[model samples]
Each structure stands twice: as structure tokens, then as C-alpha cells.
Target chain A: MHISYNQKEVLKGINLSVEKGEVVSFIGPSGTGKTTLLKCINYLEKPQQGEIQIGDLHLNYQSLSKQDILKLRRKTAMVFQMFNIFKHKTVIQNVMDAQIAVQKKSKNEAYAMSLKQLENVGLKDKINEYPSRLSGGQLQRVGIARGLALEPELILFDEPTSALDPELVEEVLKVIEDVAKSGMTTLLVTHEMDFAKRISDKVVFMENGHIVEVGTPEQIFEKSVNVRTRQFLKKIYAEQDQQKLNIKGG
Target chain B: MTLETGMQELLMEFLKTLPINIIIIILSAALGLLFAVLLTFVRLKRIPVISQLADLYVSFARSVPGLILLFIAYFGIPKVLPLIGLGTYDISPMHAAIISMGFYHSGYISEVFRPAYLAVEKSQHEAADSLGYTPMQKFFRIILPQMVPVALPGYGNALVYLIHDTSLIFAIGIVDIMGTAELSIARSYGTNQILIYFIIALMFSAMCFTTDGLVRKLEKRVAIR
Candidate 1:
């Protein structure tokens, strides 16, 4: 996929493929188009040039119709960093809204499906609470429940835990790890290197709007052949170590 | 006459015309809200020439005095209608009052509406889109419920201002509360003049209070989200 904003390229001729049910994680510094690439897949950000094939749905960005974009989005769901669940809706309604709106499920059917998914995300007790009342972890769980209720063929996590308090990050990561292990095809953009390393079937290292390296976790984290990938890992690991030491000192 | 008797007499006269005041307020508020939603839609969508025109209308409505708008609707519309070959049309004081009040206050309400709608975070739209919600579904299901609560405080103020602005209708000779009070004062040769005016002020204040209370109740209910 090639994406540009205001004549400046954001994703430069990127090509990658994910097998069904594989968990792929995209890692990079800010502004490297990891989130943009995830958005492009769901047609949230329209690429200037590229073809996206998800399931049986394929769209070339140049000729993509409005209907084509909607069709493409229908097959996938995105969990945002801020957990953009509808604040006006209760936890269950946040999950049920898409089920009823997109899938056209009856109230009873949506309720049943939403309840199950909410439970899957460990939000059964908070089903009636609004997003405002829940902690960050709980809100992201609702975000996950919203996506999972749709039963989408693929799920995109755009730094799902990026906005959380450090203490709250674990709960969200745990829910996401559960989803990944359930064999859902997932693409995640995250700064959580260890979480990405442990859960991703494949890890992609991106920088300067290009993929610098693509490899398994061990290959990328332990023995990266690319200098850029190795350098990024060393810096990130050092930061993580500093944070751990700070936590211990505090 | 005793102050008690004078007060009773003035209150009776005021009550007779209270319904007219109430009717003008309700009808004009409905009209203002309709136009406000339309204006907000145009401004938000940036609908070309019409949006620019809406911008002009909002600016005109806000910048000009309510009394001037009342005069224009009363004196201008009847003349303008004939000039446009719509034939002779007599716009009564009540109709003119409603038109002017509605149009003038829509400017204020649109300012409220546009900001409230914009205040709904952009990420909500993206979330809805990712779920494959059609535009209409996204608006009614997601945007509107959220937008209305945010819009309520300003909308309530607009309604209160609408209530206050209706007093300008008496300038055009409508027999509303103010008009009736003034008429009574003239008939009595200024007897109990201060008392009558004070009673009229009380009536307007009561209406404003009720409106604010109702809006607050509504705010609480919708804010349950």
C-alpha cells in the first residue's frame, strides 16, 4: 500500500500479507504510519494507491467506491487507543450498537451476543455502566467487546493500550492476548515490545514510512540482521529497563 | 384604589394576554430550533453558497437588535411579498413576531448546535465507521444522543432569550403581556403604573425560571449517558 497525505508519502509502497488467524504486530516510533496502515486496511484512511484484499473483498484504492469501502470495513473492526466506545451508551449498548446497526440483529439477538462478548472481556459485572464510570482497562475491554460482538473476520488494534495508565495496561493486554490466542486474525500497532514479542505470530518493524524488517519475535528482538531494527530494539529495551528501574526506585 | 385591588386588577389583565405570549414563545422556539438545525447542518457540511448565506443570516441575526428584526418582519415582509409578485399578503403582528423571534434566535441556537455537534469527538465517527454503521445510523444512534446533552445548556439559554425577546413584540402593537400592561396603564392615566410593570416583570421571570428548570431536568435525563 502507498499512502500520502498532502503530497507527502506516509506509507511508501508497503507490501505485506497475513495468513488467516495469524496475529501480526506492527511496531515503530511515532509518525511511521503504523496506525495509518491499520486505518487504511479498514478504509478509515484512504490510501493514494494500493490494493487491499481481506477475505473475498478486494479493493484498489484508486477505483474504490463508497460502497466498496463500507463493504471492506464491514469485514473488520478496529480497537482504538482511546477506546472510542460510545460514551452516551452503556457498556452493553456499546457492544450491541454495531451488532444492531451493521449486522441488523434484533434487540434480543444483539443483547445475547453482546452479553456473551462482554463476558468474554470480563465486563459482565459492568454491563450497565457507562464508559465514563469504568476505569481505562474496563473501557478498553468494552472497546474489545464492541469489536468482538461484530464477529469480524479480522480485528485491528491501533495501539489499544497506548492511552492507559501503566497499572491498567496489563488488563487490556491480557484481553488482547486472549483474543489473539483464540485464533482471530489480528493486526496490532503497539509500543508494548514484550507483549508484541510474546503474542504476535509475526512482528513487523517499521520506520520512516517503510518496513525496516519483518521477522518472528526471536529473530527481530534477539538477532535482527537490519541495523535499523536492532537499533530501535536496543533503544526501546533500554527505555523499558529505565522505566522498570524507576518503578523499583519509586 | 388599594394596592391589593390594583394588583388583582393588573394581574387579571396580564393573565388574559398571557396565552398569546406563551403561544408566541412556543411557536417561535419551534421555528427557531428547526432553522437552527438547518443552519448548523449547512455550516457543518459547508454547503457552498447556501452555507455562506446561512453564515450571513447568522451574522445578521446575531448582530442586529431583536426589535429591528421585529420591525423588518412586520413592515418589510408584507411589502417585499407584493414586490416579488406573491400578491398582497397581510402579515399580522403575531405572525411577524413569531417570524422575527424565530429567525433572530436561530442564530444563537446554531452557534450552540454547531459547537455541540463538533464537540462529539472525531474518534466516535471513526469507531462507528469501523463498525460499518451507515451514516444515518451513526448520527441517530451515536451522534445525536451525545450531541443533544452537550447542546442543552446553550439551547436552554436560547429558549430563555427567546422568552425575553418576545417582549419586543409589544413594540409592533401585539396585545401580549407587555402590550396589555401598557394598554392598562394608558387607560388608567398612569394609575398603578409601577405595580403593573412590576407584575409583568414577575411573569417574564417566572416563565424564564420554568424554562430553565425544564431544560435542567431534560439535561439530567439525557446526560444519563
Candidate 2:
């Protein structure tokens, strides 16, 4: 895949794939194309070049029709970094909107599906509340529940925890962990190294618009051969250690 | 005419013309809103020639004086229509006021609508798309509803301006509130001009204050939090 903005390349000829029921995490510094790659999978960023295959469907960016895009999107769901729950809707309505509008489900069916998904995310008590009324963690969970309501074949998480207050991050990560354990295929872009290492089946490291290394968590975290990967991990580990020391001292 | 008789006449005239003033205000505002939606959609879509045409229309409408536009519609259109083989068009003052004001107000309202729609974050569009919403569904369900609260203040202002501009219809000989007041003053040999004008001013102030209060109530109700 190749993506550019205003003639400046953002994703440079990258290739990666996820297996069925596997969780893959993309980790990189800001502006390194981690989020862009996830968006490209759903054609949200519309890479100027390359083809993407999600299961049986193939999408070539140049020739894909609007119908093809919609068909591909129907099979996938994305949880945004900002928890883009519709502000005008209550938690349950946000979850139910796509079911009724896209799946053409009856109101009763959509309501049941929404209730089940919201319950799965432990938001059974928040069904009537608007996004403005929910905390950041709860809002992200609502976003996750909305994603799950679609019953998509794949889900994408674009820095889902980056926008949350530090104290609120755990609840959202716990919900994600549960979703991963349920064996749904997921692609996540995350800054939480510990969570990524704990949950990801495969870890991919990217730098400067290119994928520098791909391996198992054990290989990437403990035994990486690539010099760039080692340097990146060393920096992140040092920051994490400093954070732990600060928390203990304070 | 005595001050007592002049005051009575002015009150009666106000009561008689109240419905016409309301009809003009409501009709122009409703039609203006419809035109604004069309203009905003065209500009947002960025269709080649049509979008440029919409831009030109808005610019011209905003810059030209409303009275001039009314005169163009009232007098100039009839002269131009026959040349186009559409036959001569003879529009009443009421029709002229409604059409010109509708077109004129759309320019300002479109300015309000565009930014309010844009103010909704891009994330909203992305979420809707990833959820597989069709373009139409996304607009109606997601975009339009969020725009309502943001657009209300501007919409309320436009309605108030429309009410004030209804007085311009008197120039075309429409028997609206302002026109009735003017006719009463003329009949009373200008002796009642000061009293009649003061009553007219007070009537407008009352309408504006009522609208302002209603808009505040609505704003509180639809506030996002």
C-alpha cells in the first residue's frame, strides 16, 4: 500500500495481513503511519495504490466502485481514537443505528442486538444516557459496543485509548481484552505497549511509513534482531520504567 | 385628527394588519430555509458548474439591496419574461415581497447552515462510514441532527431580520402593518404621524422580544449535554 497527502508519502509500499480470529497490533511513534494503515484497510484513507483483501473480498483502490466499497465496509467495523459515538443518540441508539439503517433489521431486532452488545461491554446501565453524559472510558465502550452490534467479520481499533484520561484507560482495555478472548479478528493501533504485548498474536513495528519488523510478541519484545526495532522498544521500555518509578514515589 | 382618535386608529390598523405581517414573515422564512438547504448542499457537493452558480447566486443576493431585488422581481421580471416568450408576468406585491425576501434571506441562511454543518467533526463521518451507512442515511441520521443546535441561533436571527424586512413590502403597495400605518397617517393629514410611527415601533419590539425568548427556550432544550 502507498498513501500520500499533498505529494508527501505517508504509507510507503507496506504489506501485512491478519489471520482469521487473530489479533494483530501495529505499534509505532506518531506520524509513522500506524493509524493510516488501519484506515486504509477499510479504505477510509483511500491509499493511492495497492489492493486489500478482507477474507473473500478484494478491493483495488483504483478500480473499486462505490458499491464495492460499501460491500467491503459492511464486513468490517472500526472503533475510532476519539470514540465517535453519535452525540445526538443515547448509548443504545448509537449501537442500534447501523443495524436498523444498514442491516435493514426491524426495530425490535436492532433493539435486542443493541441491548446484547451493550451488555457485553458492561454498559447495561448506560443505555439511556447520551455520549456527553458518559465518561471517556464509557464512551469508548459504547463505541466498541456499536462496532460489535454490526457482527462484522473484522474490527479495527485506531488508538482507542489514546484520548482517555489515564485513570479511565483500564476499563476500555479490559473490554478490548474480552473482545480479543472471544476470538474476533482485530487490528489495533496502540500506544499501550503492555496491553499490545499481552494480547496481540503478532506484533508489527513501523517507522517512517515502512514496516520495520514483524514477529511474535516474544520475538518483538524480548528477542528482536532488527536494530531499529530494538531502539524503539528500548525507548518505550525506559519511558514505562520511569512512569512506574514516578507512580511509586508520588 | 385629535390624539385620542389617532391612537385608536393606529391600534385598529395594527390589529387589522397583524395577520398579513405574520403571513409574510412565515412564508418568506420557510421558503428561504428551503432555498438555503439547496444552496448549502450544492456548495458542499462541489458540483462543477452548478456549485459555482450557487456561489454566484449567494454572493449577488447578499450584496444587492433587498429593495432593489424586490423591484427587479416586481417590475423588471415582467418586462424580461415577455421577451423570453414566457408571456408577461404580473405578480402581486405580496408575491413580490415573498419571492424577493425568500431569495434574499437564503444567502444569509446558507452562510449559517454551511459552517454549522462543517463544525461537526470529521470523526462523525468516518464512524458512520465504517458502520456502512449510505450517504443519504449518514446525512439524515448523523449530520443533520447535530447541525440543528448549532444552526438555531443563526436561524432565529434570520427570522427576526425577515420580520423587520416585511416593512419593505409597503414600498410595493402591500397593506401590511407598516403600509397600514403609513396609510392611516396620510388619511389623518400627517397630524398623527408621530403617534402612528411610535406604535409601529413598539409592535415590532414586542415581536422581536417574543422571538428572542422562544429561541432561548429552544436552545436550552436541545443543548448537547
Off by over 4 Å in 2: A1-8, B1-10
Best by TM-score: 1
Q: Score the docking of each candidate (DockQ).
A: 0.75, 0.84
Q: Model 1, range B119-152, lDDT digits (tens) per residue? A: 9999999999999988888899999998999999
What value does the lDDT take at residue B156 in candidate 1? 95
Residue B76, model 1: lDDT of 97
Which whole-number lDDT from 0 to 100 does residue B160 have in model 2? 84
Predicted candidate 2 versus true structure: per-residue lDDT over A1-250, tens digit per residue: 1222221399888877778899999998889989888887787888777787877887778788989889878998999999999999999999999999999999999999999999999999989998888999999999999999999999999999999999999999999999988999988999999999999999999999898998999999899999999998899999999999999999
- Cα lDDT for residue A6, model 1? 26
| Residue B224 in model 2: lDDT | 79
* Least accurate 10 contiguous residues by lDDT in model 2 chain B: B1-10
